[model samples]
Target: MSTLAIDKRTLRQDTWWLEPMLVVLGLGAFAVYSTWAALQNGNYYAAPYLSPFYSPCLAINCEHVSVPLFGSWYNWSPAILILWIPGGFRLTCYYYRKAYYRSFFWSPPACAVRDAASGYSGETRFPFILQNIHRYFFWASLPILAFLWWDAIIAFNFGGSFGIGLGTLVLIANAALLSLYSFSCHSCRHLCGGGLNSFKTAPGRYKAWGIITKLNEKHMQIAWTSLVWVGLTDVYVRLLAHGVIQDLRFI
Candidate 1:
């Protein structure tokens, strides 16, 4: 027995895995819930309110007529094709990438932990490199947000007059949170002219960039809240569509 070297990566081991564990739990729950909701494919629309899960309902045969913004013809799960826009944007989101890369892939789950792999090459090759398309997805996601806002706006139109309901408020919250999440994105921040050479010339972009920079500070928090709100919005619409609950109108 010659000499042995101890891997002294961490000494104080008080709940070091807590953060990663929480991330796994939170993301896992969202994944499970979203999957179930998508597969159910029922109760996604009700009168003036359409579930975020099935907006811009492109299929003519969409169960609900108020939706079908594109005259649905696909005759499949609209959410399947439609949800991917926002889904891909979030999946490639810089903040979410960091959270999942560490927790889900366990590339050194915490500051002092050792990674499962021997070396860190970064996002240089193959699948990891695909993250570069996040900016493209960001652009693609903008139009969908317009659709979501349309849904939120129409939600207030109960029989052509001003109206409010539990669903209306939920849709409003969902749209608001999603807007925050999307606009607060690092990509959005950069698009707002963050890399500008001088603010003296581009006053408009500078103003917009300044607002985005402030919002970007809380991007991670808004991301989580928006994710949760989108799901809850769909849930509320589901229950209302299924007659599991009433709309609880207040206008």
Candidate 2:
């Protein structure tokens, strides 16, 4: 009698697919919501609170003039121009790459699991090679982060006077979380100490490297938190702008 051998993807498995499934759900939901919000072009700004998606609003139709790079003849969402900065930053992010590659591509969805594809070229080819520009995206994101902080600072100003509101806190938290995420980036760490021959020789850079390393340790957690928080921040601003909810003043 001839026996047939059955091939298996992984032998040691304890619900390994759960994590990837959850990643898909989270990323999918955020993508859908963010795309819809960006296309609205309205309800992204309310006094003292501007959605991060619409900040640095470069469109001719923007309620708040932010550079006004586009001509009056131009018509579309201002977000399309700026969202690419943050979007690209996250798309090429180290943690995000692993998350999407596994969940979306099923490229060894979990450790010990077989990749869906038969051949593994690894990010050496055309499109994946673009991920090497993540450092450039990191640099571009700094100004956006600065603008977010500026927005958060202005959120405390109610008609040129100091004030606080729920939206103010939200914006502040959004900026803070994003700052953590950005500073904790692998590129940021490399920038701080990439070429140092010895940490003892470069004390200041060594310190900065140490600090960024600490943040990098929590990079994955901060990445997820910042991702969720930023989306919620935009939603909050949208609700305020649309008059769906009134921002409660704390002081």
Candidate 3:
């Protein structure tokens, strides 16, 4: 519990800063890799498998995961256009906000620890207020998740024939993990049951909200798992695209 006492005090403990340091390293590494991957347009898709970065491939030049719906009028990386949805959603996520706030900003880094900044204004100002748009991102992510599910299903086929391969399994796991992450989101919880006046009125939605609420309890775990799996999915597809590794088949 925070006290109103004006005392220049700090937690007398070992490893207080460890959590923040790990957060910095983890987030920084992911940022660098995602930026590098997004710039590589042609390298994103492998035959019958699409990197999440380039799912619903909109460019005409998409050779592997070729949908080409918008027509290739502009010569630009497709990720720049599509990455914003999930990127924005995760950026504004309530869990992530607490994460970066402590890790990057050192704002009261740990319980009973003082914030590094002396004077602070809360999220009512400038860009901090932008987080209120998270729910909108949650809305946008629904369609994107549908698209990803479609892509994962599409991965099971090779040359118009039903088949199974290592990539198929990877894509399946990636989609499943990501779905769990989204379902477990706090916004999703609210959408399901937060506004309800009485659970006795809506049995179906109430049941769903109950399940989602359980997922919400493990939100942090799902969030990190999805993050790691996404990167792994991209790496597996990249290797296949480059012929660095071949997809192993079963059935």
Candidate 4:
């Protein structure tokens, strides 16, 4: 029998509820934690700088942004807000697609399944088929990263006022996060080398792509590392804003 067949047999024999349940639990925990953290740091409501940029309409009022954990307070943003959406998107990435589908979608093990069981064989659908959206997201995120880098610069200019002046550590963390997210994207990998049929024909492009592939191979590791560090960077900013964290400057 093939390896996929063995995996399918094992999956069939395994308990289905455990993986799905764990997915729910994990998502729930992250939602709760993120909501609580935002509320605690006064981010649930619009920041002073953000208010002038966008007005709160009745339907999209910021006050409606709250997650129901213990008692539902006006938590500021919905649990499914933009901050949390990225997590869901990343969880569904091509590299993570199989692991997450099995856990969240209860997909059968593809390696063991034969004849249209590899998870890719399906009627094309919207949103679920929206994994292709990452290509757009990859390009879009670059501009956001540029703004983040600018924010870091402003933080330095103000000498870290109102917690806006992020420290060097935070700056480094931000750069690392941007690098990991940008470099690990599937679109970037494809642009690097996946599209090329023959390296000998396009030696220059092939060499450049070869370098990018090395980076892409470690994409998952970079993704997780950057995720953790970016969260910490936000925490640092919040702590400084609230006067709970201090920036140590020398010279």
lDDT of 4 by residue, 66-159 (tens): 2223234433433233443355446546665655565555464343433324456442686577676766666655654654565444444443
Give the TM-scores of the predictions, in the order they appear.
0.92, 0.95, 0.93, 0.62
Predictions in order: lDDT: 0.85, 0.91, 0.85, 0.52
Clashes in model 4: which pairs?
A: 4-111, 4-112, 5-112, 65-76, 65-77, 155-165, 160-165
Off by over 4 Å in 1: 1-6, 65-73
Specify the highest-lDDT model's number: 2
lDDT of 2: 0.91
What is candidate 4's CA lDDT for residue 222? 71
Kindly give the stretch of ten consecutive residues in candidate 2 with the minimal lDDT sum. Answer: 1-10
RMSD in angstroms between candidate 2 and the native structure over all alpha carbons: 2.2
lDDT of 1 by residue, 1-251 (tens): 43345465556568888999999999999999987887776678888889888776776677754355554446567677688888899899999999998898888788777887888877998788989899888898888788888888888998879998888888888888988988999998888988888989999999999999999999999999999889888888888888989899898
The Cα error of candidate 3 at residue 12, in Å, is 2.5
Better of 1 and 3 by TM-score: 3
Clashes of each: 5, 0, 0, 7
Q: Least lDDT summed over 10 consecutive residues: which range in candidate 4?
A: 49-58
